[model samples]
Target: MPLMNWDSSLDVGVDKMNDEHQQILSLMNHIYDAREAGRSGPDVIALVDRLGQVTIDHFRDEEAYMEQIGYAGIASHKLIHKDLLDKFTGYASDIKGSGGQVPEKFLTFLKLWLTAHIRGIDMKYSPKADLLKAG
Candidate 1:
């Protein structure tokens, strides 16, 4: 089974951000599947590293979009992103140090954080934009 399934609830109402979230979800599943298949350490490590990069890119884009849309929480959102990235960096570093074998706890953290951040945190932005519409 996938580590995390994307539901409509995770939709942040921005197409680009939604797509990026999907990509992140997919990568999370890939890691889960790799573990199930008993994939090698180096391979899993590579995937983890790629996921990290993609996350960084996505966060940058998301933050920029938040700014452009005048999301009220942009400042706090940026801080949250930084804090999450720091946490993720620590987890990724641990996995790499252990030769790429991702632990169950990290996967658990991944699920919890992504779901909460997207639904609880990210869900805040879209409605604001909708409220501020020109039309």
Candidate 2:
């Protein structure tokens, strides 16, 4: 089974954002699969690297969308993103510095953060977008 399944509730009512979210979830599953399969160090490292890049791109797109939509909580939203990014960056550095065995804690953190952010922060931006889409 995949580490994280895409819950319908995570849908933010934006096509692009939803797609990005799915991609992230997919990458998370890839990480889990790699660990479970006892994949080589370079294999897991490549997956992690791709995940980081995808996350960066997604955040940029989401933040830009928030700005375009005039979301009032944009500042706080950006702050949340920044904090998560910093955490991931630290984990990535550690993985690279070490022999590429990702700490289980890092996977746990990603799972928790992604779910929480989607249900909380991402949902905050969803209502207005839904309203706009409906009207």
Candidate 3:
């Protein structure tokens, strides 16, 4: 089974953002696959690092989109992003410091955060911004 699976319900009504989210989900699964396939520790760590970086890039893109659409909740949304980034930074540090084994809590947190943020927080912006919802 994949570490994480993207559901259509997680779509935030924005094509670009949804694509980014899918990429994030793919990267998450890549980490799991790497470990499952007995890839080297460094390889798994690299995947984790890439996932973190891609997440940061996605947040930047999402924030920019929010700005373009004049999203009223941008400030709060940015805070949420920052909080997640801070937590990711800490998790990355711990993973690397401990030789690349991802803690269970880290996976749990990522799963919960992505699901909640995409469905709850991300959903709020589109309707408020009057953007056309994508299928």
Candidate 4:
């Protein structure tokens, strides 16, 4: 089974962002697959690192989109992004130092955070906020 699943509730009413979210979900699964396949510790760590980088890039893109659309909640949203990144980095660091399978708590964190962030937070900037919603 995949480590992450993207559902309709996570749709933020923007094509680009939704695509990025799907990509992130795929990367999460790749990390799980690597570990399950008994890939080297470094290999798994690298996947984790790649996930982090991809998430950072996605957040930057999302923020830029919000700015282009004049999202009123950009400042607070950016702060939330920062907090999420900090927590993600902490989990990545822990996983790297431990040198084993991804922790269950980490997986839980990813699932919960992505679900809520997209469905709850991201959706706030959707609809009237996102010009592409009408598309």
Ten-residue stretch with the least lDDT total in model 4: 126-135
Candidate 2 error regions (>4 Å) = 128-135
Better of 1 and 2 by lDDT: 2
For residues 15-82, what per-residue lDDT tens digits would candidate 3 score against the true structure?
A: 89989999998987787676676564677788889999999999999999989988889999999999
Give the true-structure RMSD of model 4: 3.2
Clash count of each predicted structure: 0, 0, 0, 0
Model 3 Cα displacement at 88 (Å)?
Answer: 0.5
Question: What tens-digit string does per-residue lDDT give for candidate 2 at 88-108?
Answer: 999888877776777789889
Query: All models: lDDT?
Result: 0.87, 0.88, 0.84, 0.85
Top candidate when judged by lDDT against the true structure:
2
**What pairs collide in candidate 1?**
none
Candidate 3 local Cα displacement, residue 120, angstroms? 0.9
1-135: candidate 4 lDDT, tens digit per residue: 887778877787789999999988988888777766766477788888999999999999999999998989999999999999999999999988988458778877888888889877898788634555565
Higher-TM-score candidate of 1 and 3: 1
Backbone clash tally for model 1? 0
